[model samples]
Target chain A: MKPLTTEEIRAVIAAGKLRDNLFKATGVFCLALALIVIVALVADMVIKGSDRFTLDFFLNFASRRATQAGILSAWVGSLLVMLVTAMAAVPLGVAAGLYLEEYAKRNWLTNLIEINITNLAAVPSIVYGLLALGIFVYQFGLGQSILSAGLTLALLILPIIIVATREAIRAIPAMIREGSMAVGATRWQTCRYHIVPYAMPGILTGVIIGLARAIGETAPIITIGALTFIAFLPPAPLSTLGDGSTAGLFDWVMAPFTVMPIQIFNWTSRPDPAFEVNAAAAGFVLMAMVLSMNAVAIFLRYKMRKNIKW
Target chain B: MQIHDNPTLKAEARNLNFFYGEAKALKNINMPIYDKKVTALIGPSGCGKSTYLRSFNRMHDLYPGNRYEGEIRFFPDNTNLLAAEVDPIEVRMRIGMVFQKPNPFPKSIFENVAYGLRVRGENNKRVLDDKVEHALKGAAIWDEVKDRLADLASNLSGGQQQRLCIARALATDPELLLFDEPTSALDPIATGAIEELIHELKKRVTILIVTHNMQQAARVSDYTAYMFLGEMVEFGKTDEIFIKPKDKRTEDYITGRMG
Candidate 1:
């Protein structure tokens, strides 16, 4: 074939250049679109809710008058529910993760369990809410309390934590295990000191993310019959005021409660227009809580990465 | 495989046959490992030298589908280490191992060496500090790392890390040490330093080293076993084996005629 002229070659090179720019521009446009939507939505919530975002809004209980409404009981309930969720989920999830990654045999039974856990993470949160309603609230007679709500949220996030733990455990080099065993350490002792410490940062990152999700969960709590108009705080776990005469730990766990998301949902659905401002304000508070939790996780991950080199 | 001259036999393998799944990796093999002496196993790649070393401490138990038939007997106790009633963990404690590559824990240098003592319930601070120092000194790395005991072991160079692993094994005071190509990953200088350390270590512990370097086998080991495929071709004193091998294959290997 005859060689093409230099002018023809220039035209083909220019066309390739145009295609490269098109792809790069498209990627930038997609990222900018996503960021703009998030900023706009957050700004809208902050502006609409600015008037109701006062200390009084945090102190006062939910009321019929929109101006008088506050998230006192909602915030408290959210904090208590999250505490219970973490206490229940962390140990169980880490143990299950460790067992599957370190001890479980690579048989069809373990394979089935592994596949099921992955599928569970993808299932709808509302499905978990329904399951909690049937089992914890009705069948077990936990009865629309903080314990039932916390347990429901725990089940919803267990798969997430376990998967994260497994990933963390898998990241460790097999050489470390061999070195430990070579020194006469038992399998459990090696895992306890060497393997677990090495894997902690990863496991903690996963657990915190799971907790952040648990804090924002509304459907499961709602399905478990958590009240939207709670007016009083759950009992305190420990009170050193006078001879232990105040609310005991049992009351806190068994008391009826409502979280921020459920409270915001209730206010938004109300017929009163003033309650709409109240709802946006509650949404702002909820978003702040979730964002702060995630920020902590990110900070911890950075510190861990810096402390470890290999 | 009967030997009556050496009265200080620390360990002995009799009719050992090893298999992975249905494929055999080693044929019936017997060799005597003497106390306070350094023995080297030199062979070409995939010759089962490392497999033979790993069998001493039962590292093969880590995986499934690996089978061992025959016996490895420990002297003084006359215990068959491969017997069903024997605890693999106990056997490992008595027979320490260093792998082909340096594998240090992601911890402080002090902690890496102290791990063996801590696992065995020696929590006294004074006792741990003493043993850690002694072991590090024994590995010939105390002077270089004495100031940075609290620093992470991963920060050390490859040679230092390997020495730290040796110290970790020594901290437990094992009578026998297995080195599986311990210097193959090191530079020539590091390899020389380690060979020197192995010479020193033989005074206190029995050493079985598997090496691909024929010169290393001659330089460091008191006795040498030349293996090919899955069988032992010859076993004798280091000087005798290097100068005049019994088997044609052994002579061919050392002289660079064939692997």
Candidate 2:
């Protein structure tokens, strides 16, 4: 059939090879582009912020006296708020996740709930800020306190935790359930003893990732009316956000609190040259916290994959 | 011609009918699983042989839209399997099973066998160590994998994995071992090894195996039950079932005259 000219055959082969080549190259190109973008972003964040990384930046709270100020209060505030959020949100989110993925009956209500959760996950952090402002501050009388802000952040990130938990649960094979049942294990035992242990790493990874997102958030805490300029190192303890006064519940409701995002926002906007360096250093510290959480997540993921059996 | 009752005819089914929604899967299954004797169920694919076997422990209970309209009873000394108060979990503990695929829990080899012992609440390390070794030896895989006890079971070969599953089931020290096409997923060499193990196993425990391999049914089982279209067509001594089956259908199946 190819008794024709060599050049023509060569041309035809080249065209076919090029088409096949392009088909395979498309996926590779997409992957390469993704890697390049990630590298570029990390490089940019590091260059812009890391040079100014300092200990004093983490020790002293923001001061009106620009040249001497650091992100101490904001750092402490962010850590406190996130810890509280993690404490409040993780258990509830994971429990809800377990119920939905493992125990929920396949009914209309569950379907509705699942759909709403997905939509909630898509809701902008800005909307959560508005939610914090209206219900938490005004209606519930929580005001702009760290407690109110933490509740807002918890609500914002709970959907992510649930979704991640569900995925982790789903990754467990049906055979494990069957095998457990066949060996006289109760349904609860199958879940609690066999299933949950297997799903732990994935769920942990999800929580760490969700926390990273929560810590990096700015707009929602802003809407909660977190103060940008709080000279005090949180009043309650190593972790209190505002004045730490739940004053008679109602008076307590009408108090002001500040968080890391507000401090970052406040620092980033100041009209001073030295304050900008503190902002970058604070940014660096913020990046470290998020990256460390991510590292824990990555380690958990590796352990999970290594330990997972067929 | 003779169906002798060994004292352990502890588990018995009388006119049991299993239906999957609208489709009848097991029709009037009247079988007696004798104590301490291997009774193998052999049939072609889709013959409801596994269905009859699964009915013994009600393994299909978890599946939706499947119903049984007849009785499966256990002995008084053994407790009634069909009793309303009877827990399927307890029944499962009594009648442990191994599947066609080698399903090792994503655990260490030692942990896999020890899983049943642990579930049964035998936590003593010495006891676990002994039981693990005993069960492994019983399945004829102990010598091969005895050293790699702490390694992941997924690292084992197909045959070794299947043997490990058998060892795991055996660790519970169940009265009956239900093997659902156990060797179907194995190579010829592995299949032979498992068959030899089964021959050795029937000496102590009741082994009920389901297989499409007619030769295997003839080779391993002391008593063989032939099934087709959800019905137990004929059952007798393995030699008689293969050589001189009373029913024309059984003879047809054995002689390759029919499926």
Give the winner by DockQ: 2
Please give me the DockQ of candidate 1 compared with the native complex.
Answer: 0.60
Residues A8-109 of candidate 1: C-alpha lDDT, one tens digit per residue: 999999999999999999999999999999899888889889999899999999998999999999999999999889899989999999999888888999
Per-model RMSD to reference: 3.3, 4.3
The value of fnat for model 2 is: 0.65
lDDT of 2 by residue, A1-310 (tens): 6486999889999999999999889989999999999778666656666655667656776778765677776777787778768887898888899888777777789999999999999999999999888998899887677678778889988998999889988988877777777777777777777777888888888788788889988898877778878776545423434566443523322345566666767877888766766666666678778888888779877877797877
DockQ of each: 0.60, 0.62
Error of 1 at A229 (Å): 0.5
Worst 10 residues of 1 chain A by lDDT: A235-244
lDDT of 1 by residue, B1-259 (tens): 2223564989998999999889888888899988888899998898899988998898887777888999999987978888878988899989999888898887899998999899889999999999999999999999999999999898999989899999999999998999999988899998888999999998899999999999999999888999888898799888889999989999999999877
- For each of the candidates, what fraction of the native contacts does it recover? 0.69, 0.65
